[model samples]
Target chain A: MITTRATTRGAAAAVLGSAIALAAGTASAQQPAQSVKLGVVSFLTGPAAGPFGIPARNAAEILIEGLNTGKVPAPYNKVGFGGAKIESKIVDEAGSTAQQVTEYRNLVQRDGVDAIVGYISSGNCLAVTPVAEELKTITVLFDCGTPRIFEEAPRKYVFRATPHATMDSVGAARYIVEKKKNITAYSGINQNYAWGQDSWRDFVLAMKTLAPKATVDKELFPKLFAGEYGAEVSALLTSKSQVIHTSFWNGDLESFIFQSSARGLPQRIPIIMTAGETAVARLGPKMPDGTIIGARGSHGAFFSPDNELNRWFRQAYVDRFGVQPTYPSYHMAQSILGLKAAWEKAAAAKNDARPSVDEVIAAFEGLEFQAPSTTIKMALGKGHQGIGDISYGTYKYNKQKGQPEIVDVVRYPAECVNPPADMTSTAWLEGGMKGAKCK
Target chain B: MTNRSTLIGALAFLVLAAAAPALPPWLISLATIAFAHALVVLGLVIMWRAGLVSFGQALYYAVGAYCVALVSRFTGITDAFVLIVLGGLAAGLLAVLVGFLLARYREIFFAMLSLAMSMILYGVLVKTEALGSTDGFNVAPATFLGYAPEGAMLNLALFWLVLVLSALAAAAIGVYFRSVAGAIAVPVRDNEIRIEFLGLSVNRLIHLKLVIAGILGGVGGALAAMTISHVDPNMAYWTTSGGFVFVTILAGAGSIAAAFVGSFAFEMLRSIAVALLPGAWQLILGSVLLITILFVPDGLGSLFMRKTRGKEGEPA
Candidate 1:
């Protein structure tokens, strides 16, 4: 089952005739002309900029630069049906659900964008979905993990380049089932949003399947981006569970760790933070050491013989931005490259012309592409959502990056965990997931 | 009252109402918000007439907005008719509760303490994302009875909706002034003991006035939420409560219709100023507020009133 599931998001990119948004007077007049403007929504400033905004900036700058510099591959420069070159204009989607909607409108109506990119927060992605559908443009998300996005709309013009990290809940539960067979009870303190809710749900279901003996002690929903957890931390500390799981991130998670460590939450239950990898690099020492940590992408971190692509990317990013990119930046690099791969693949498949968005999406269905992170494979499922490699990592200090990276990360190939698209919760539960210890 | 003042008030309201439907989407939104805020301020003008400034106005406003949100989210009763009633009823109940505590206080204590009441609701909303946290709830598209509102027609319908509600609220206050209760409620501000000795319950009158004020404020909030289809925690913030107070002070206690005019002026000025200056519009508003409060303490509403009253109104 694991082997079969790993290959579900089998193809990363490339389809028949996809068209990217194009800018005015950029590349509208050529062989096969197709024109459109893409609205790029990302946090250009604010707390999320370090993780989210910069990566988006890098993707837009690099991709557009690639196109403008004549470095773009064949078909892309050749023009398409509408005589439009892919033009992406960026807008600041900083703060709140309401602000995102405003920026989305400005991009769609004011800037005249036909496609969209971005959404660091799963909640933001949810907010933008209705508008995207109303505008009838392909919205490709780079770094959001709420599984509900896929469930709510399957064939809609939305695509997710990154697979869910919450699948690690299964990986974590699987490890616990095999490693610590006896520890059973658990409690969850999560941000009150879809991502937090699902992270806990998956872990709970997975643990419940592995060992029926496990018990859930308490569930607390602190406000997302709370940046403070005094009350929730106190509640969790008193709950008395053998295990604790949280998926707090950015300043919110960091602030929680700072407060929790002071209250000695680490002294009691083993804390399993799904987004712990994102925290360690910035707050390694501050993070309560030995807290059960798993990077959703990689269980633990490890660096192998430097791949040429990885090295090139690292150098290029540092050369341009003066800093090595993080997971967000790396994920963005992969997402943009994905479009490129689709353009190349579509051209080769057809008369070698600029591709349409439908063609790109078609190319993306069951496609695989290599990235600095891993060989990404995509399974176009419900809502055009795809699943691929979900890696896991534990905290370890890396001096050069000057933070703790997920050490000894395990790359979970698209098998064993992720089910087929039509597999219902009940069907998946009945198969190898019964008697699981969720806590 | 001079015919010119009445004529100007009527003309201003009509022009605003008419231009509202023709304006661009952004300007319409801005003017609509201003009008809603102005409606609430009109109720505050009644309280201010009694020399009592209540800052706890957001209590009713949020109650109304949330009532609409709660009913809309929890049930299928999303018609504008039902939502307006729910907003008014919810705000009325909260007013009944807050008015009890507010009855005893006057002057700065009443204003300060009233602000506290609105702040309590804000705290709860900021902490609860299920209620949309600080981001607030997305007002799903609303219907007006069996007729669905959309496009410029929707804006026109909403404008008429505001006009009808504003007129009803203003007319209710007008009728209240002619009654024994409204007269006595004003005396509670000048001499509470004197009014009590006159064999009327002064606190009771204050409570009724507060409830009326709350309903007006709530109706304003509900209308706002319907027009925007988005509500946030800031709607309940003390700053919002303060904005209503500022508007009422600017409008004075000249007439209920003054609320509509004051709000229209504030909104139009704000929109044009904002479009021209962008971020510095707040500076322009602050200056206008400062100058108005300093030079025209009676409020922008008193512009409709003559320089002095002809009749020696009873002090008690």
Candidate 2:
């Protein structure tokens, strides 16, 4: 009977030990989720890599890690901010509409992500905007050139890091106007999407407004990335356009450059790629010098000696990612910085360590922050998106590095070009280009 | 397989179909997609019943999508019901026209030719800028008999419509399968000489089957376009057709009920895969597909029936 009692005690002790171990495990998880969920949507794997897609991803990754390590202070040190280590979920849209729709649904409904970043294609962003609105999630669009993003008038939750495609074209037009050449018969070989169509329409409008003498010869809107462009190229050659501008990027851009160069189209006419800072260096000897382009902003290249943020951001980017940061990378970095600034403000006002979306939104009202591109001030005076630097520039190849950098970079200020709360950028541009200036 | 049981089952199926709309919204949306596509699967099975396998039903599917894009985008008609009919009619007419060429071929030839036709549509969508090229066109917010489908009401209405269409399709196919004419179609594969000697028009029968399949494919594409409220060029691409083929194979050529179940299962699995491992969802699905094909050649429908039959019969 005594031995039986001892065995019961022994079993109880074993049970108690196992329970303690389980409790300890539950308590002291080494990888506790102080980790905030970040869902990044980019064209990571497919044809969109070289242009806005990869750069956006590179920026998000570098910025996220930096913010996590307390090296960068934007998202972490925001006004009402508490440090939350961000764990990222990345998706690649292989340039397919169905896949993109599926990806957007997954990002919102399943991931339960705190916020979203990076949407490289304008068509993709337009498709996802409804989902974002429906889900009521905060999204920082690193790059999607559609004017429709703002034209449709976004909720307070959605913010864009880049200028509208129309404004991008306006910047390009400004540069073209400065050249002082009678560019007769400008032809456009643009991809048939919101960005390309919007840019073409806006550029023509701006060019007509500024230089009415220039007539558009041929406007070729090809399917974005179908791999064969011989027919389109041949048609363009026969058409009478002194200047030919394209908005193709990544593999499509690479193919076009190689094809056109081989076909001797480059020697005959001026070829301006509206995508100012794609993986231009990767194109190597093929990309000609001085191709006109636009960016999330021109601040990716810190040419000015006075700006400290530019210097620091560029240095930090080079240190973090081996490559000099592209326009989209800088754009994404700026968005995180914007979020951090607002969060810190909210925190300071509430005297609480963590701030919610409403507090952050309040803080974002009329808050100005310096980024690599230019200074962006979020003005809630009109209850619409009033942030971002409308910076544009031209690409010049650095032969030593064999990479292209934005030269003759023109940074458009908020007062000069950003739309008023009452009117869209299109309406504002329509109202006689009044306050619009070139840096 | 018996006539008495088939009639009873069909009647019971009709009675239960009334309760289909009570499920969750996502489930219904997915099921609606399945039911609509199940009609298409029934077409594939009808072809399979005649002893032919097709890998390129996407050709007619593409025709249906392009019809929607053309009518809605160019004409600016927002009536969902009318637009769906228009899409179906457009696809059917095209199919009947293309059927002349397709009916002449058999087996792999028909499959390859159908694929070639889909590729042609893909080319047109990618090359023509007036049609927005490969970016395609978006369906404007639609009105179903003047009722806007923008919210929960839309889902309910769509569910009901899908249910009605599915039942009608089942009844039609069931009646056809039971008919004397339908019985003769089987001999087209098994005893061509006997069928020929019997003075039946073999090519005409094949052509009729193609037309029926084409109509069903068109209806599925139209329903899909309505559900998403967006359409693009890739809808016509061979991959889109491949997905439908995969669904038909996965569900097997059994009861129409299996189509709804299979589509729901596929959607759930895809969603789960997307959630757990966002990057490898496709790979995971592909692997499962391979496994399913190898283990269950008769498809998911056969499994449940076989198991039930085994339990009722004598034990091993």
lDDT of every predicted structure (CA atoms): 0.65, 0.65
lDDT of 1 at A416: 49
Interface RMSD of 2: 10.8
Candidate 2: deviation at residue A78, Å? 4.1
Per-model chain A TM: 0.77, 0.80
- Evaluate model 2: give its TM-score: 0.79
Q: What are the per-residue Cα lDDT tens digits for candidate 2 across B134-235?
A: 445555555777777655566557667766777677677777767765666678879777887888888888888888888878877777666555566677
lDDT of 1: 0.65
C-alpha root-mean-square deviation, each candidate: 12.0, 8.6
lDDT of 2 by residue, A1-439 (tens): 3353344346335534543453354234333445566788776554566566677777877767766777653334321125656777887755345446555655654445667776876656665665566556677676666555666554666776455566567766766776647777788887765556666777777777777899988888776675567887898788777777777766777778778777877667767666745546466456765566555356444322245556666677778767767677776777777766766677678775567767776676667776655666664223324455555555566779865566666666555555555566677667756655445
- CAPRI accuracy category, model 1: incorrect
Candidate 1, A25-85: lDDT as tens digits:
2234332335546566667666777656766577566655555444444433433212246
